[model samples]
Target: MRVMVASLAAVLLASPALAADPVQGRWITEEKDAVITIAPCGAKLCGRLSKFLVAPPQGIDQRDVNNKDASKRSRKLLGMPVLTGFVENGDEWRGTIYDPKSGKTYRSILQRKGSNQLTVKGCLGPFCQTQTWRKAG
Candidate 1:
């Protein structure tokens, strides 16, 4: 029926663009220190620290104590969002990455390296660093 066909078309059109991108999943940092889970935050992609391979020196309750924003310094490391505001841009995702260790935020980009890898880059003007993160199990 026409009604059924129109309903199907509407559902397809309403799907998110991320359906074609495999960025939603768990990934381990290059250093194997932390695991970040990437998922949809409204219409944008965001990553949060799900676990730490190496225990924090300050213990499990470790806080973002170094954050210059005094109000945010007390935030716990676990479940803290590190990558946010990401929007798909062709082959890469453009966004900002927060470095909890340095308490700084940098303009960042995430490029799919392979089926199970991603190259994350953070830039501050002309300075930039790239890390290859493996898709976690």
Candidate 2:
């Protein structure tokens, strides 16, 4: 029926630009300390800390004591969302990245380089730090 055809078309047409986003995957941080997985979340893409390669000083079962929000301080860091509110912007995705160590949030931009590397930039106004993340194995 036309209704069935329209529904199928709606789903297909709704799936646009982001369907082939190469940056949507797991990546190892520059320090090789953790693995973050990037995936679609709502209207934008978000990355979450999926695994810890090295245990924190507080051990593997660490709580987010450094979190600025008192209510969230007791939360666990594993599976915590590090990158959020990211939306496609040309060759890069701009968003916010949270540093669990510092308990601060910074503006972040992400771009994929080649097939195995991703450039992550965290910015504080005019100054920015860059790190290259490798594809997670």
Candidate 3:
């Protein structure tokens, strides 16, 4: 009985770590405009734009000209860390998401759907927009 109890305790203690974070991979945004790679950053998870599938809009700077911080305005959009400060919340993750298009930051939640789909939500007050992303090869 003692051995069985100890084995059960060990398994329960190790299960969370054994279940890897499903967001730790490349994902194609719902708009199919870009791919972002999610990975561990310190104790939290963050995502960065890794590739652009479509050509950037013409007649506009390819830089982060709309960023609130003037110094960051010159930074390139590609390879930018748009998702940050995410912490695990049960099966989902809560964080902040940056929209370079609008140069705004909003409360975000990311949840995995099956093994290949991820739902990304950004909320401003009672208004929230959801985008579903697919696993990228």
Clashes of each: 0, 0, 0
The per-model lDDT (C-alpha) reads 0.91, 0.92, 0.89
lDDT of 3 by residue, 24-123 (tens): 8999999998899999999999999888887677422378888999999988888899999998887789999999989999999999888899999999
TM-score of each model, paired residue for residue: 0.83, 0.83, 0.82
Alpha-carbon lDDT of model 3: 0.89
CA RMSD, predictions in order: 6.5, 7.6, 3.5
Ranking by TM-score: 1, 2, 3
Model 2 clash tally, residue pairs: 0
Write down the RMSD of candidate 2 (Cα, Å). 7.6
| Quality of model 2 by C-alpha lDDT | 0.92
lDDT of 2 by residue, 37-133 (tens): 9999999999999999999988878989998999999988999999999988877899999999999999999998899999999999999999999
Superposed model 1: Cα runs more than 4 Å off: 1-20
TM for candidate 1 is 0.83
Question: On a 0 to 100 scale, what is the lDDT of residue 58 in model 1?
Answer: 94
Q: RMSD, model 3, all Cα superposed? A: 3.5
